[model samples]
Target: MPRLPPVDRLDLDDLVHRYAVLVDQRAFTAVGELFTPDAELVLPDPPTSLRPTVEVRGRDAVIGALGRLTGFAATFHAVVGRVADADPGDPDRATGRVACEAHHVSVDEDGRARDLTWYLHYDDAYARIDDRWLIARRALSVDVIATGPVRKVRADG
Candidate 1:
């Protein structure tokens, strides 16, 4: 098995970071470009909830789901940490875990401003497609979630 090159590792890191930037910019459609055509996104059900998990396949479906973010006034996704490695026997295949925090500001159904933050970790499987690394599968695990009214506090105190 050949060792993974440093350049490939950096490219993987860049791909993870780029997702945050694209999502923050509300470029939902463009997000699909970072994934393979048959990619899948698996999202766990919220803690203590009876809701079913989110499982979506195909690039178009992924883009459509992200487009739902229009409900939020603003959103920011940051990749706080990541660890990835190429498969020892298959250089084109890799696996990784990414820790991220996503903040969303939106107006509730009643019109009040609400702030929601989700701390999550993504377990990812990547594949080198057409000379570029793209996500083939991703499973998101939620660590913590917080919600509250959007408040303004003076910093001059």
Candidate 2:
């Protein structure tokens, strides 16, 4: 067996951490900045519960989409598994996949609690810009989701 290169290990680890931080913190702006200019995020074929194929072009769109996702007020992301897979020919660019569990916290009018369950898979591309790794493309695949909390909703009078 041969030992992996140290630079490869560190970059891979940093890439993983960057992804974790953005998703965990609902930092879409940061997420959009993790890829290359021509990066493409492909959402694998799946069911309706999961989002269909969405191609987000350019950093602004990525940032916009993220804003909409985070506009709800509160969201939590928990990513599982290693995220360094799609190495883009060059060390400066790469692709990867990550499994994530998301907890959404929303407060409706009158301060009512609204919660939802989101199971997701993120396919991403990363590029090195200005000596920093950034996300270029990101596509989301949702496996299972519930619109309401575990408890049944009570009808309002």
Candidate 3:
């Protein structure tokens, strides 16, 4: 049990916010800088094109796995909410739930960008180490997704 630094509270918030922004923007390499050496990322139903239920361990593997998403040129949008719990023993260790709705878009043969939406929830574990806060693990629960003829455009409009 390590005493949390006074400034760590702010770091925790920034860490969560960064996750939302970086992931959506596909900043895979840059995102790596936010994590500790031994980080883990668990993605459930990561887009159809990617392997669903992927578990990435270690900083490099996590970053590499996320990097794969860029291949499709699709967006991995995340909407996070509420710091459910944080380990008081270690300000670097916390648990959170994030609500997310993801959408992927690409040009159809006709060259019109077709969009699809997915709804899911994220259960996260976070840890602070070396004066940096990082995601320890993330468990994703998929609620529903729109596919085939039911896909809708992203709200970015």
Candidate 4:
């Protein structure tokens, strides 16, 4: 298959980066716009967390699932890298692997805060619809987790 067009490649890259930005901003509702109506998101069960593997289907469900991040005081997701290509027989379809580092901050009952970081990657399938690129399916795989106390510093505006 021919390489993905430069414009499509950039668009896919921007699409993934938008996910990181929206997630970090806790804009779960707006994030739904980046996905297809029937998109799916699959999350692995982390070794340190008791949560089972989670599979959410549909844009609404994906939004609801992302809202769980609100349990943390804050989260920062950095998109480290990504590689994507057009499907062999379909220019409107593509697949990619995106690496990310997600940091979650949580304050305990006594007011001490800690950071839990997950080094992970997403295997994504994308589809172009109505001249826009949207994630059709994404499966997250966590490679490592690190937890430590954090001394947060803030400045008043």
Quantify all predictions' global Cα lDDT against the true fold. 0.83, 0.62, 0.67, 0.88
lDDT of 3 by residue, 88-155 (tens): 66555777777777766664666456556677777777776776677777776777877533244454
* Ordering by TM-score: 4, 1, 3, 2
Q: What residue runs in model 3 are displaced by over 4 Å at the alpha carbon?
A: 1-9, 46-52, 73-80, 147-157
Worst lDDT 10-window in candidate 2: 148-157
Worst 10 residues of 1 by lDDT: 148-157
Q: Estimate each model's TM-score.
A: 0.86, 0.68, 0.73, 0.92
- Root-mean-square deviation of each candidate, in angstroms? 4.4, 5.8, 4.7, 2.4
Candidate 3 lDDT score at position 148: 39
**Native RMSD of candidate 1 (Å):** 4.4
lDDT of 2 by residue, 1-62 (tens): 12324665467567766766785567776766665665565453444436746666776666
Predicted structure 1: lDDT = 0.83
Q: Candidate 3 — which pairs collide?
A: 92-127, 92-128
Model 4 segments beyond 4 Å from truth? 48-52, 153-157
Q: After TM-score superposition, what is the CA distance of residue 99 in candidate 1 from its true location, in Å?
A: 0.1
lDDT of 2 at 94: 65
lDDT of 2 at 60: 64
Off by over 4 Å in 1: 1-3, 47-52, 109-111, 152-157
Greater lDDT among 1 and 2 belongs to 1
